[model samples]
Every structure is written in structure tokens, then in C-alpha cells.
Target: MSELVEIREDAPGGPAARALFDEYIELVRERLSLPADFEPPEHIFASADVFTGDGAAWLVIFDAAGEPIGCGGLRVLEPALGEIKRMFVSARARRGGHGRRLLRELERRAAAAGMERVRLLTTVVLHEACVLYATEGYREIDRIQPPAGPPEIWLEKPLYS
Candidate 1:
């Protein structure tokens, strides 16, 4: 059995965390065959940027090998709301309930941070992720075609009363 691990949020910008974040992005791009222009924003990857009063809080989950296999974050948009961004789980780690765990953890953290609800944007091409969010109680709020790309769907869920 693979050993589940607990990750600390204190070292959110450390080397291991950063490397895993990069790998997670790469996996998504490859698996989804996303357009070249669909890259993640650079601000989230820049340690200084993510922490500089920005709307981001990074989290990572490591596997038995002490490798980060999953990650996501709560981007505080307001005192009672947050945005979930960059959620990813490696192929090898899927079907093991890690994604659900990560999602729950993120929601808990957001609630602890005083957020009442959390939201996220995702592409239709990522069908699995969309289904996962829906199953986890995220309701679709909108779908819009951005100026530079395909249509994106917005989903939101309340984390607290």
C-alpha cells in the first residue's frame, strides 16, 4: 500500500513544491493536449508573487516516495470568497482518492481563512475534472468564451454556513 502523507503549508514555495507544481502543469498539458497558449499564469509560480498580497495560497500533497503528486490552492478573492486554482493530480495518483482529499483540504483551509465559499474555472476539455467538481457539490455558475481561447466554465461551492 502507498503511504499517504501530510504536507505543511508553511513551505509552500519550496523547491520540492515548486518542482511538483511544474510537473503537474506539464501532465495536464500533455493529457489534455491543451493549446500552447493555455499555459498557467507565471505569477502563481513565482514565490515572491504568490505571497505578495496576491490572491493565492499554494498547497501540495506528497506520495510515499516523498514526491508531490497533487496540488491546488485557495486564492482569496474577498473576506468570504475564494478561488480554487491550479488543482492537479498526477496520472499515477488518480483513482486513489487523492484528488478528493486535496479538494477537502483546500476547502477546509479556505474556511479556516474565513472564506464562506470557493470558486473555480475549468475548460470543457477537462471532462474528468468537471465531473469531479460537480460530484463534489460545485454548481455551475457560468460558461464564457474568453477573448483569447475556448469556452471556460465557472463552478462554485459553499464551504461554510
Candidate 2:
């Protein structure tokens, strides 16, 4: 049977949030073939304060059995700019529209927070994510070589007309 999925907003760094973040990090590391010692930057694994503060939000998706399946977060970058961080859907949940749902919710929350634009960074290894962002109206900005992780493709979307 198909499971009912629910998305709920919550403070970051909680048990469920941390579990999802860890899963996301591990998946990225493995998918990008990063070394075992590699660690994601602090900004990507946001602290509770960041999500609870002004112009920020965290969302976690749970299945009908109350198992966490996916999560994403939005953080204010500037007065009218926000960033999408740590978006992930478990392997078991792939191809089921949960990622798209989480992304749309993040955009809606960002717009509700008065952000006119949103940006995100994903690696070349994450081709599915690149396609999703592009299909959702986010345009490629540039390529960035971050100090800690794999090379990334930067993307931005205008939230308002």
C-alpha cells in the first residue's frame, strides 16, 4: 500500500532533523566519492538557531508510520534572499514525488518569509537534483569549488514576478 506522507516544519538540530541531515551527508559523500574523513561545511548542517531565527524554516517529511523520509531547509542569506539547504529523499522514497513536494514547500516558505529570490548548490554528481531545480525554474548561476566538498553548481530562482 502507498504510505501517506506529511511535511511538518520544525526547529533544526532536533533528533529527526539530525538523522535526516546525517543521511543526506552520507549519501552525498558516497555519491561524490569523497574521502571517509570528509565533512560537510557548517552552513549545510544548520544549527537550531538558524532555522528558528528570522526568515528561516526547516521541514521534515514523515510517512504514515511516522518514519522520517525526507527533509529540506531554507535560510535567509540577505534581506530578500534565501538559500535551500540539505534537501534529501531516502532511496526507498525516490520517484514518488516527495522531493518535488519538499522543494515546493521550501519555496513557499521562502516566499512567505518575504524572500524575492532563492539559491542552492548541488554537485554534478547529483544530476537528478540539477534536473529538478532547473525544471522548477531555478537557473544555473555558476560553478563553485568549495574548500571542503566536491565542485558544485550554483542555482538561483526568483520567487516573485
Query: lDDT by residue for model 1 over 1-161, one digit each (tens)?
Result: 25576654635667766776667667567766766556565532334344324445677778877777777777777888888877777677787788888888888888887889998888786777887898999998989876654578989999864
Off by over 4 Å in 2: 146-150
- For candidate 2, the lDDT comes to 0.83
Steric clash count of candidate 2: 0
- Predicted structure 1: lDDT: 0.73
Q: How would you encode candidate 2's per-residue C-alpha lDDT over 58-88 as one tens digit per residue?
A: 8998998898888888889898999998888
Q: For each candidate in turn, give its C-alpha RMSD to the true structure in angstroms.
A: 3.4, 2.1
- TM-score for candidate 1, please give it: 0.79
Clashing pairs in 2: none
Each model's total of backbone clashes? 0, 0
Task: Give TM per candidate.
Answer: 0.79, 0.89
